[model samples]
Target: MPLVRIDVIEHRRTSEQLRELADAVQDVMLETFAAPARDRYQIITEHRPGRIIAEDTGLGYTRSEDVVVVQILQQGRDEAQKRAVYRALAERLRERTGLDPQDLIVAVSANTRADWSFGEGQAQFLEGRL
Candidate 1:
């Protein structure tokens, strides 16, 4: 399995909203990648608006407002599949918050199946090779 890791750069998202974001990403993976609903891993980060800087043509590099960045890390998948999943992700975000597609940038990191664990000293997804 190619481990897909996601890093989301966001601007001042509420705690509850952050959780929703994680779930949304998981949903996308499950639907597009054909991953099981139980097979899930997501990380959500919230950043202060004044702290994060988004490049806008106007405003001369001001802080971003109401923006979310999603990073995804997954395994056991190819590039085409990964890109498709990302496109789906962008659409979901737009549907959720009326945000511009440019506001969300998703990049999937490819990883080997050897580096994953679900619980206490367990690597079930690894098929016990480790």
Candidate 2:
């Protein structure tokens, strides 16, 4: 199992639109990754279109345009899987939100269970350590 964290940054035009877009993105991700619904985490941040500055730091950000960055964290250490997941979410988000696909940036990072902490002074996840 893996934990996913999604961060979406875009123009703060309307709350309804932002919420709908975020929900749709999460839906696509959960299905694509075969992840449990509860394991999926999405964080949406709204910014003014004029205030956003997209930079190309391998994540392919275009300056002077609003953007949405989707970060997917998984257990399996597969680069292709991450790309596929990001593309899937970005595609679905664009389709549902009517947002320009060019403005959306999808990035994925995978981590092992040992790397995660459940908080509250809990122990880290370890194989066969339960």
Clashes of each: 18, 0
Per-residue accuracy of model 1 over 32-72 as CA lDDT, tens digit each: 88886466666455554455555655744332365555656
TM-score of each: 0.71, 0.70
Runs in model 2 lying further than 4 Å from the true structure: 1-11, 48-51, 56-64, 127-130
Query: Tens digit of lDDT per residue, candidate 2, span 45-89?
Result: 555455555667787545334466666666764666666766776
lDDT of 2: 0.62
> Which residue pairs clash within candidate 2?
none
- Which candidate tops lDDT? 1
Candidate 1 global CA lDDT score: 0.63
